[model samples]
Target: MNQHLRRLAFACTLFYTAAFASASQEKAKAPDAPAATRSRTLVIEPFMRVTNSSPTVVELQIALRKFTAPGGKGPAVWLSAVSHIGETNYYGALQKHLDAQALVLFEGVQARASTNAPAPEAARGAPTKEPAATQPAAPAKAAAPPDKSAKQTSIQHTLAESLGLVFQLEAIDYKRATFRNSDLSIQELQKIMEGDPDDPADASPAKKNEQLDRLVKVMDGSSFVGKMFAGVIQIIGTSPRLQGLTRLALIETLGQIRGDITQMNGLPPDMQTLMKVLIVERNRAVMKDLKSELEKAEPAKSISIFYGAGHMEDFERRLRRELKLEPGETLWLPAFSVDLQKAGLSKFETEMIRGMVKKQMEVILP
Candidate 1:
């Protein structure tokens, strides 16, 4: 049972990490050190990472990168990779940064009926010549019925509470005028996953949905394993020692995985397909919106794409290939960090937990 629980924890951790990667900044004064004397910072990877700043302190950081068209003639684009859950101030800082942009293309899948079809003017990716004051406001549509599949407990919210952090939706204000939805409707995603009826090459929708449902149950704390996982999360939440140990374990596990989307090749076919849809197909939607915006007669001077870290790599590629954009500056935001000593873990205990996590990763990843 103990071994089973351990495996379950690892599985749950990996899934959420990937899914959310498929979903912060401390203002620190720079030291007055000479450039040559300063320690070299680690090269930024594609999206998320786990870094150890000290022997006892570890952090999980997400990336925000800038890209621009050739000769810097067009509007600059920013790819802000975010976690589904993070420190309060991190989101606050992120919000401040995004508020500076003329437009923000964000990710949020809604029901088909609830999704607002882009206006004909916006569809053409051009600003209407009519004055803003002359344009009538859109009527508020009735809310779509709640999705049954989404009734399950939110794993991201639960994990946020357990870790004393905040969920992204609760922390970031998405209602701003600058924000625009650039994701598929939930029904559209489901249809794609369901596969085409006439194409035998497509995987069976029933089989795929069944597999997806099982995974959702596990993630949302509905299944037996999920209950056990929630119990573990609760225990970790209540005990500082457990929190510290769990943080260490997570750091080790995430360190090995490194938020590389390719690492998901080891997962089951259904899961791989799910991720492909979640990251790739949705990315196509975002790029479509991006191209539309760029085609506008007077496009926003600056635009930002706020999406799960897992999707950034594909977005980067699209920006480079389709838009002919060049990568520019990058910023690392600390999402979650923990001090082993402060959390009541000794040096030996930290090392021990890390060793255990490494062994589990060996089995899981191998």
Candidate 2:
């Protein structure tokens, strides 16, 4: 192995030791870092920034556990796309790090038309300019163009409404701005999907998946949806409105999509990165905004987010810098801990999950 790999391995080891010890303090109390020495930090990843480089998946998982070290009072940890993207990359490693508990999953795309949209022209006291009573006789009214936003809202609402039936969180990709819009429809979306393409067997998985994904969208591209979601994520990242419930809603939305996400309409490969921006990066943006929100919302004892694994790098870095992340600070609490307990492992098994997570950190982030 090269020197770089060796160093990484060593770093992973130290972090894993620290994290595992902290989460399972029953073994031995991890040394407490001085309180004032730290400012609360958020952990994010460079999944967006780093490309063409294959960071060890195992190593990254190790790092995740360390950063998300549960039972630590330092910084909080949030992870997403952890199990959704490339095989064995993030979510693939999840088999080992069962300690990671995701609170929400993304649903679908929805956004306000613009980030800086002014209040409705009417609301601003702007006088309405009525059309002139010109010479032409009135023709029969045509059918109304579909309301794109409303279409998306119905889908999102339906999905959210259905989520509690199965998962603990509401998984989704929809944005609030999109929900605010009144124009959208299931028929319009189906028409959009109908024109996309047919999949050939030889096509790559990504391509096939993109095609399949679009089949599910029922609508064509909505730039309004895209930009709106980006804006809301930006708003959530920096705004003071972030409360645990809101964050929970977001996490649950994303998580619910994990299983339901079908590759009917595959997006461009670049969109893989974009989705990360939508899901994970937005989480960072929301948390960055959360600093201000924390004063009011009373941030959770902890929160776990699961989205595209690709966004892990970008979001984790953002969390560290913005949230003042400390190692082993954020613990990935498992929502299904009891489920794991019943899976044949005793309390000792739970400790094993903690150790497994620690091992991944030890393996990856050195």
Candidate 3:
């Protein structure tokens, strides 16, 4: 039983790390420009990374990358990749930096209507369809609701507390006037995941729902794995030493897969499809809003897309191919750090933990 729990804990750690690393919210609008041709090359620098200051300390960092049009003619756009949870000071620094921007296109899925009745377009307060070419501006909407799914507990929040960190939603202020909702509505996200009835190529609704339920259970801490993982986290939370070790394992795992798109290859088919909707489809919505903003007579001089680090790669592609933007300066911010020495770990134990995490990641990632 003890060995079983240990294996379960390691699996859960890797799964959640990958899920969070690749996770963010989005919508289904098509891009204004032709799709960028796929290439084997990477166009932008990695937006997330893990670094070892010494054998006894490690750090997880996120990047805020800036981009601009040819000769830096247009607005300076910043893609601020963020972790869903991090140190309080990390969020504070990020919030201050973003507050200087004239417009902030942020990511957060809106709430589902409680009933079957369609939510009014105006109540939702954003363009339901793609913005017309002649339209100068898209309708402004309030920041999206705090949680994506009404039924699920805020997994990010729970994880933050367990790790002695702060949740992004709580730490960053989204209520500012400069911030705009640039993600898929929960209804739209569900429609995409449910598969189009007219398109026979899409998966069956029942199958999609089954996969979605499994995902929700894992995220909401209701699945056997989630329950066991949460129990492990709770135990870790009680001890500074355990929390430090868990943080180290997460850093190592995340660093190994940072900005590697192939990491999705390990996911089940159904879950992969869901990730597509979450990352790719929603990215379209962001580009849609960005286009509208750029079309404005007086667009913001500096605009920022505040989203999860997982969304940065796709966003970089869209900005380059669709908008003809060029990458510029990159600012790295530390999100989480652990001091193994302070946590009572020695060189032998630290190396042992690193070895175990590496072995597990090898099994999970192709």
Alpha carbon lDDT of each predicted model: 0.63, 0.30, 0.68
Taking all chains together, each candidate's TM-score versus the true structure is: 0.76, 0.27, 0.82
Worst lDDT window (10 residues) for model 1? Answer: 22-31
lDDT of 1 by residue, 263-350 (tens): 4446665565565555555666667778878898998899998877656765675676556688899898888788977987677766
Which sections of candidate 3 miss by over 4 Å?
Answer: 1-9, 25-40, 53-55, 110-141, 145-152, 196-202, 222-228, 259-263
Write candidate 2's Cα lDDT for 28-135 as tens digits: 111234575345443332222111122211112222333433355533544533321122223334433323332222212222122222232211111112124521
Q: Comparing 1 and 3 by TM-score, which wins?
A: 3
lDDT score, candidate 3? 0.68
If candidate 2 were superposed on the true structure by all CA atoms, what would the RMSD be?
19.9
The per-residue C-alpha lDDT of model 2 at residue 124 equals 19
Cα deviation at 248, candidate 2, in Å, is 34
- True lDDT of residue 327, candidate 3: 92
**Which residue runs of candidate 1 sit more than 4 Å off their true CA positions?**
1-12, 18-44, 110-152, 196-202, 213-228, 258-266, 356-366
Report model 3's TM-score to 2 decimal places.
Answer: 0.82
Q: Is candidate 1 or candidate 3 better by lDDT?
A: 3
How big is the positional error of residue 237 in model 2, measured in Å on the Cα after superposition?
Answer: 40
Steric clash pairs (candidate 3): 26-184, 26-282, 27-282
